[model samples]
Target: MSTDTSSEQRIQLRLGSEAATEELARKLASALDEGCVVGLSGRLGAGKTVFCRGLAEGRGVDPREVSSPSFVYLQSYEGDSGPFHHADLYRLGSMDDAAIEEAIDGTGLQHVLGAAGLAAVEWWEFYRGPVPQKLVTVEIAVENPEYRSIELKFAGQGLQRALDAVS
Candidate 1:
């Protein structure tokens, strides 16, 4: 793992297996505070959902209950800390910004993001709408079938603290 805590701070981790990725995500989740927003960007089969599952587990939710909300666009779970919201925007990639905004609003994503809980959105690059101020972005780069390079950027002090703790 490598970290840069400069003005544009970020943490990068090399995960050699799916389990490692999930474990890292769980640690991050545990360190995060409520009302934090996490945006995940990665290619298909990049373990985004796996990370979400770990995140849910860290928040005291059943990991098996967390899945990619690709079809439904969003899913919500009650966790020990608070509500955990998962959103997927892969299907909206081709849509224009306005349409994407409409879809987000229609799915109640706008309301859930940065609410009194943790919100994670997969394929977050597809959404061009205004994002929550308390946001953390994770970019997973596939190094191979079983390995991934994960980079995280924080946009809030709470998120930075969370990253520090996780790192």
Candidate 2:
């Protein structure tokens, strides 16, 4: 495991394999408190859903039950701490500001954004503006077919503590 803390409120990790990526997700899950939001940014096939599975596993949910919410938009499951909400906005392509706001309102994303539980949003760039202020941003870069570089950023005390613990 490798960690870097050079950037302000950021942690970068070099994951050698899928297992390593999942392990890092599990570690982050262990440190997250209620009402935490994890924004995931990455291209297709970057293991975003796999990382979410690890997160669900760490939160005492069945990892196998965690899947990408690409078509449905969001999926909710009972976690050890509380509710775990997962959202994928990849399918909502090219939306105007009004459409985005309407989608946020119609899907109850606004509620999830502020809810007292853990939430992970894939393709978070689509709705970045409404995400909670205290956010943990995870950006995954594909170094190879099986390798990934993940960058995490946050300023909340809970997330900072998680970073410190994992580091």
TM-score of 1: 0.93
TM-scores, in order shown? 0.93, 0.90
lDDT of 2 by residue, 20-104 (tens): 8888888888788788888898999998998898888778788889888877888999977778888888866678877877776
Candidate 2 local Cα displacement, residue 159, angstroms: 2.3
- Error in Å for residue 93 of model 1: 0.5
Worst 10 residues of 2 by lDDT: 1-10
Off by over 4 Å in 1: 1-7
lDDT per residue for candidate 1 within 1-167, as digits (tens), equals 54433334678889998888888888888888888888999999998999998899888899999888889999999999889999999999988888988888899998888788899999989876676777888999999888899999887654656877667
Q: How accurate is candidate 1 locally (lDDT)?
A: 0.86
Q: Report lDDT per candidate.
A: 0.86, 0.80
